[model samples]
Target chain A: MVTKFRTTIAALAASTILATSAFAGELVINTDTSDPAPKAAFEQLIADFEAANPDITVKWNLFDHEGYKTSIRNFLTADAPDLANWYAGNRMLPYVNAGLFEDVSDVWEENGLNESLASAAGSMTIDGKKWGVPYTYYQWGVYYRKDIFEANGIEVPTNWDEFKAAGATLTEAGVTPITIGTKYLWTAGGVFDYLNLRTNGYDFHMALTKGEVEWTDPRVVDTMNNWKELIDAGFFLENHSSYSWQEALAPMVADDAAMYIMGNFAVAPLREAGLTDDQLGFFQFPVINPDVPLAEEAPTDTLHIPANASNKEDARKFLAFLATADVQTKINETLGQLPIHKDATVGDDKFLQAGYAMLSSTDGGIAQFFDRDAPAEMAKVGMEGFQEFMVKPDRLDAILARLEKTRQRVYK
Target chain B: MSASRASRFNQRSLAPVLFLAPAVLFFLFYVIFPIFQSIQISLYDWDGLGPKTYVGVDNYVELMDDEAFYTSLKNNVIWLVLYMLAIPAGLFIALFLNQTVFGMRLYKSLFFFPFVISQVVVGLVFTWFYDPSYGLLNVILGWFGMGPIAILGDETWVTYGIIFAGLWPQTAYCMILYITGLNAVDPEQIEAGRLDNAKGWKMLWYIILPQLKPATFIALVVTVIGALRSFDLVSIMTAGGPWGSSRVLAYYMYEKAFSEYGFRMGYGAAIAVVLFLIMMIYITFFLVKMYRDEKGL
Candidate 1:
């Protein structure tokens, strides 16, 4: 009895010491994972993290998707949470430059994330230092209707000419070749990104978005001319600007439209709208110029610790925990996206598998979408110009001039 | 005793100022102070995260060259002019529904229903109604062998389309005002005009209109303010889209400051200052007219 009591007491004392050694503080996290899948992913992630570290208590604040964009600016400068969610690439440049976010290169070095998250490392780096850890990303490509393609006798286009021919064939069949809603403007940006990436190569496209190349550069005009051909052929849905990205899905679902250049998230809604796997397929955005190497767009979502955070130690611990291959696998499973960790296994969902395969083979480069690659002001102006160009192809010169003027002002 | 009585008299004189101080201070703090604050902010360059840098009228200069600003300004003017139609339309509807009949209350409520609905709901309803593929508007047009006009999509018609949606609720609000005015209207004068052989249009023009002056005044003021501050509908329906053909000054300010890509607080403040200056002109005109009319009475 005496020996058993002594052993129990010793075990209790060791546990107490372990608990005390663990940073027992409230770690506040703010995130815009308000979408059902992402919300569930975060809920599970937080619960598991808490279970792993018994002494640490987490306080999570879920923010509205749209409102959080502006609210992050407010909270980061004052009354900041220990960690927050943000996007990768130039989108986080403003915060990084302002010193609102904590530099977390140490986390990357210690966790061997330099090798594990290598594909996204370039995007996370600014000034030769990693700013945040990208957790999940989804590929953007041409999501088309297999039934419509079959009906028109069109195969998946591998090059620019074939893509145009497919659109022409679909158009002849009285189906809108490409369905897009430029109402919110980012849909047009996606189309522009793919075209520019394919036409000018990823490096030139990056230079253009970074404001190093002038907007009126001949290469940009080449891209615009290519886009104009598609527009002139009436390849897009009529009155597309009147609808949102979701609303445009109606025509595609009803077989009035054939294809949409969109991200993998569209797969969910398309599935929900009753499109079977046999009816739907995704193809990489086709090559525009044979000279340019193929690149892909996969906008990444990332997490960061604020510079003003009180509990840096716990935040770093949580960052390491969140960056684990197992955690990433679980996250991407729920998020319907690709995981950043190299060893993270993706779900058997056909679209997820396809995205994983496509991204894996991409040797040229990966872009973080147009709006994310460019600064915010430039993105807004550039997308507006793209929408206008898509509608009135004749306005290309004027739009390019306006964009050039804006680039001068914005970059300055 | 004499000195004490003098002090009491002074206290009586000062009591009204003391009583008025709280409200005056609130007005200064909430309304007047913000106007100056916006003007001050307009002269600086601020992204809300970093320190503000004063650029001294540069934002205003930039606005001069901004085509989008011109577009918003032109749209605002269109809204102001087109919005005035609500008042006359409301008066006519009030005249039609003013008659005593069975179930008139139900009809009146039905007419007032649009105003009772929130602006967000109204925006959504109209957005669906104007939808190119399946909207009721297109359905009606089909029966007439007309076009499936994409009003919201066309840059030419986008502003007008948003104005039409805004007019629905404004018309209903004006109708309620006219209804209440018609209730308070002098039946004796209407009878006098009738006895003078003044028939429908003449009676409404001479007799009924004079009494509705107050209602017209209130309606005009509210409509103008509503037209100027049309941020909610623009935000909800199209988000000033179809390439920003429908943006107003208020919506432009929000886009500059609070939009996902926008945190240029100084530019937003400049826009707010411009909008406030425009509103002040009308408000001053209203105050002067009201004062003159009161003095005349």
Candidate 2:
């Protein structure tokens, strides 16, 4: 009787497994794009993908923005979906290393994505193989007040000396040179990325974040010293550690601050807060050393097929569809971000256009934001160090020592 | 088998055993097993995903050197000590409200409102109240021309600020508990105490205090647990910032295990084990005291 019962249960499980595999036409896509814009963008993209391939019936599962991070681990190995949206660079490293994510180099090769998605190709590749297809990205730069700059006769500060002079002028005029909220820690990272990228160059910055370079290296010290110069000059908004990135916008909105080192996403909020396009403007981060090429931070968002996916053919088709220029253009317009495809045009928004121009012309390189580029453990420890260093510049030596220790642990 | 032998397997002992079997299994599976499992996991080095490697106390060894652990331990100590203030505060409020007066029900409910509101909302409210530029705290300080203070941002003051927010709800809960206990106090004993010129402090000490022992015991148990379980306020208010100076053990464990940039399950388990050991001490003490009280009764 027990053997018969066991056989019956085994048969039931086998049948369910067979049923799931048999439904090849059903393609399940999971993504954490629950925000209004990204949700609408995916709604449009999925509708288009299904319309293009009518044989494929798409099943899209939208996850909450925060909860998806932890849930993705469970779903990947237990009940895998065909496609998942995630960030590029080291953020996807763990999954890649664990063999949970499928290699999509064939998709890149078949679709000629290497040339078109060139800017993001470097980030998407690990161990000389493409892991995913990048769909969208947004540029990070110094977003400043145009009216304040005009009033103070600041001509966008092309170099470090000019930047400092501009800041000095702003200070004399009783205006903050920069406003940032390091309360969440990543804002400090954005500042650090620009500083490090400028002071040590993009390749060096990437090497450091990847844990090849020591945190206490002389080049890193140069970056920190430059950051300390700004801190000593009192260029940052006071009490910024008390605010979130959104709360920090208040100073810029009220014209108390002139500039912010932020992503293109900040434009919409700034405009919503009553700053006209005429009043708000964007500029690339200024050059600190003439020898280093100009690098920009633009975090890429990609979609991948899980290694355990049942509908491999349909998933590949969906990825190819997502990589198309026209689709990228339309989705990015709705999402208010830049498309990965080289030929895709940015939206009509001034910030978007400016970001597109700056990124396309960048000779140095592009970096995924600090959190995405670094391992998770290192990122958390490093960002905390960055925030602490900003708030307490005297702790720089201690902070660097701690970050070095974290690097030693995380990489191993 | 003989009929007498078969009949000896009676319902008396079997019935009680059979009835409690399901509950015991559930307790073992859900409660007792997880405790051992967490302790076992604490010795391994694993991210939430992938194969776990047996590191054999390496996680604990690393935890010993972890500065965040030390900070969390210190904060937890502070939380434990300061959280005791809630018990006495609740008793005083309970005593104040125990009197018969006009429209007293409104006053009592109003005082109970903090406990009724969810902890997340309380955290958010307190977050805004401590906002450096434009919070109620800063506004009050500004009235005296002392200027703004970033309560949640300052590492030295952040844990205390969150603890105060936690205390608001905790004190109210203790007040409600005391109020319920107050209802069962013997009136004859109180009348005799009053006749013996035992009023105010003396009456409360000799007659009222001894009777409220059960309530105090429950209050002590709940408050101690609540202090150790403080995660919501810390999570919502500052997220263990500015730079993780506000992390208690529970929050630190959560940060290590589940935060966006964290997945060190082994480290998280180690932290959980430490917390569990601390809680075990309290639980064992409570059980002993409860057993003694039962024996005395």
Candidate 3:
């Protein structure tokens, strides 16, 4: 009886030692930034954060972007890290609603992030509380070949008529006007979002995405009709559905296509493809309706603390550090994206400057891209319908009707 | 006295039960338990991470009206039917390579190389080969003045493109199996058939193929299972794109469960239950055949 009692006491002591050592002063972070530049930037951020806090050690787990999406659900419930990388706005809604993400309003308040990070506050807020800290977001617009425009004697399009006229001139010159790949389907969403935002204004576009307005509404039909005009002109690269977004850039690089409507991320690839700044120019997606406000597409990436985190104090510290203007500027410089902190100064990169100006224009506030704005279920069907419409414009009615059915079912 | 002791121990021994405990426990926990659990989960409306509300067959009811479900079912049928062609094709290659010639062993290994690579690699290679602008297939067709065909982009052809990619490795696998079976063939029977003036197709059909029943059975069973579980190739090559025209049941179930398209876990479980039932039919058939064969042996 004495030996049994001794063994039990020994076992209890061993477990206590193990438990304390496992979690003491160790902050775990799970991130999904598979792209080389962003991954390097995050690694640097971690190094800086670690240097700033000598007492605390960080354990970083990096996941490939696609696999991370599926695994996040598993890890967030089973063995959540102290902090995780996620997105702002509707993408983070489900997690916030499920209480998987912790409320980090204290972090914001303690760091005085309200003024510096004010631009992204609206997106990160849920139920009158902040759920995450948005670090980076970039603008989407028309990137055109300036040399081609000059050679064709065409002016930069400011509105729908000029845009169509430019397309006609490019088509006559044997150049596809726009190069877009819809094989992965999200590229179609980019085009559809711009059209919907420009045609029906941001409120109606948000309403449609939120399923408050029917997809079959006449306003949506008007958007499709405008899109149909571009499709009918044969402006897009031929056999575009066969390529990914990167592959579609080949035509633009080769002067076979003159323009691409894409995010600011494409600037690096365009430069790598041997285009000079003089050759490439940026413009906002042309105004379809002059009276409508021009809301831009800006999908923000965020950092969040999981509700079940074991090291909440350290996680909050890291989030506060990440929200600083210096840290935000450094990271966004590496990422080639706009910083969320208002005081964070971007480098003299022309595209970054243009993106900052365009996104911050007084015409309208930012609208997250279609897939990010809508629930994922609705986005999948909506994007598929957009792709189908691009291929067969005559099927617009059928496609919109089908999307209406999915929206009703999903949002219900 | 020792003999009596040994007999008593044998009569009351728990050795056999203890020996089987680990494997039986694992089988129950990992395989048997999950199947029933999935069935239970399929009766609810759960989004994987949230509270489950029991909705009782509503997912299946919703699936009835889902056009994507019908598309997946049709594609699965196509996959199953076309996958069987691998067996005959493999046999043909095995016969062609089963000869006494210089470098014959190397030839056999070369023919078996595709099966050695992972299906994901094969899918990627075929995706590149079918690329419309800069693919080998299009390059070859260009010599004949034929234009490009976007096989993966066209809904009508995307399923066939993926299936063809899947069949490449599957056929190689069957070929290796048949070659092994041919190595164990009774040469005396072949000589006897030669003496009877049976050669070529006649000798192969009547004399040789009869000895390959076991190999044929294994090949058929694996091919059928592979066809039904053809998620990797479709996922890698096309991701059921061109408006989901190429989705098989397995891929569709995964999409419903884990994709960014909302985590409808209960709906996905229902789809999995349907796939399981379909696979169970073949499993029962295979087991019954094996049992009969065992009795015959």
Candidate 4:
């Protein structure tokens, strides 16, 4: 069945490419990154794709992160890209629900993508349909300065208490302990996710965001309480309200702050700041209470085709190409992210290697980041609630109550 | 003779209507049409795409119980009321600069500078100025033996801080308008009032005050609109943050329709309708006054 599906997708894309080329048609692709590696990767892909199948020129409308969101939405509702890179979780659900995205389930089955795909990526499916394809994903956790840990004679922590002690060790060294940028709000969400996942486990996080569980549940309260304890211990940087994540990265790299709980993308910036692989290391968020079921760090970021696409066959071809082991390995090596391809080879970046090991060996996947998992409206409200809790722990009940009200209005 | 007179009256009436056609068309298409569409959209449950469900008054009903919406609405009211202080403050400065002094023209131009720059840039500049550790305001405060305060981070003070930033330019705008009005301030009356011993505050109150009414009205109109339309500053400075304490209706509407969360366009339009209704109160009053004055009543 999978073989037949793959063959059908290949045939379909080939025909579309052939027909489109005969007419001098152009393809537009919208992407979120202009990073050197991805820019080069995309250009190479376009060059190769065009070389193999002449007559279809590709136009790249690349934007930075924030601009990409706005531009993509504007373009989709007006004139959309033939292929676009987007988040795969509930972030893409609205488009799917609106029938704005085309189902590429045939392409997924044909490419054998559904066979080994983890449920994390599989969660992108809505109403038993696939809207987009997985490109590259990375695990988010604490990227600690290994040298600092070594210099202070503190071992990397594997559990919650030891993590707190490690934080104390860094603090006693006059380090800010954990560097974050709450100004963007999502950084706070990253911390909150790590804490919540560690405390309440993956299923409950899903339950809470899906409105199946109350945000004021004892487990949820415990998550906030856990975060407050960290804050009370002076684990986070002071003046977090004023700094951005990139700006906060400076202190961490400077050894003034010992760790940053960030995603795999942060690896490149850390390297750019002159930190060597041997100098940095990763640890899964320490288990909270040790009684909670262990959940891996979040794996997210996907590439999908727009449903209103003009050349969906070519789009499917591209998704299959992206899923191939060879391309995945090459992209992974350059981008320093985890390849969704089961047999893809990883490169020598210690941080990437560590993240690869952690995510590959995890017991279960934590679908998407908090913001991506929840409905957009609910996530925004909930994230603000998280920030408010961080700002004033005493307001936890009020914040949860407010978010509960939003969930009722939104989900209903 | 009666037929010729009737033709003459028709031409007189038609000429003014022909002249007003373009402006009326523009206003209807751009202003009147969109407002009605927004109101209609607000009556539905839509996410900017797919099917729009007819939710009737459900959206408004939901909004009434929404603490976030109420918080935003209340904040907007506070902004509107506090933002009006700019008019009188600007008038005082204009009166200061209305005299002959050394390089008064240069001083006046410099004072008017903030009003000319874009609001986005103004928001950024003020954000830096209000930064707790490194901001200029705090640096000066530190020298005076005061400690740093997180103006944007503290929920209690953030709205007031943004309003202060907004006032800087608003006051300048009002000053320029007042200066224009003061230029035509009937100088002979000032001398007559002086002769009558109506000096200082009394002279200004009884004589000069009435003449500045036109400028005051315009300033009030602009100030009120500016306050209600204050999304750029809040978006830039705090993004309705430090616990969602700084949100006003405009920013709240934007957050609902766009941004990271789902695009709840119908709900967004509903919030926008509420904001519009509140602004309409002031807008109607201004229009009525303008209409009366137009008729020389």
Q: What are the candidates' individual DockQ scores?
A: 0.42, 0.57, 0.53, 0.37
- Name model 1 segments beyond 4 Å from true: A1-24, B1-11
TM-score of each: 0.95, 0.95, 0.94, 0.91
Ranking by DockQ: 2, 3, 1, 4
What fraction of the reference interface contacts is present in each model, in order?
Answer: 0.80, 0.73, 0.61, 0.48
Candidate 2 residue lDDT tens string, A1-412: 2243235444654454222232779998889999889999999999999999999999888889888887677667666789889999999999999899999999999999999988899999999999999999999999999999999898999999999999999999999999999888999999999999999899998899889999999999999999999999999988787899999999999989999999988988898899998999988899999999999999999999999898989999999999999999999999999999989988998888989989889999899989999998899999999888888999999999999989998887
Docking class of 3: medium
True contacts kept of 2: 0.73
Q: Which ten contiguous residues of candidate 2 chain A have the minimum total lDDT?
A: A13-22
Candidate 1 chain A: 10-residue stretch with minimal lDDT: A15-24
Q: Show model 2 residue runs off by greater than 4 Å.
A: A1-22, B1-10
lDDT (tens digit, per residue) of candidate 3 on B1-297: 999999778767867777889999999987998798789888998876667799998999998889889999999999999999999999999989999999999999998999999998999899899999899999999999996988998888999999999889899989989999999999999999999999889998999999998899899988999999999998888778877788999999999988878588889999999999999999899889889988995
Q: What's the lDDT for residue B43 in model 1?
A: 92
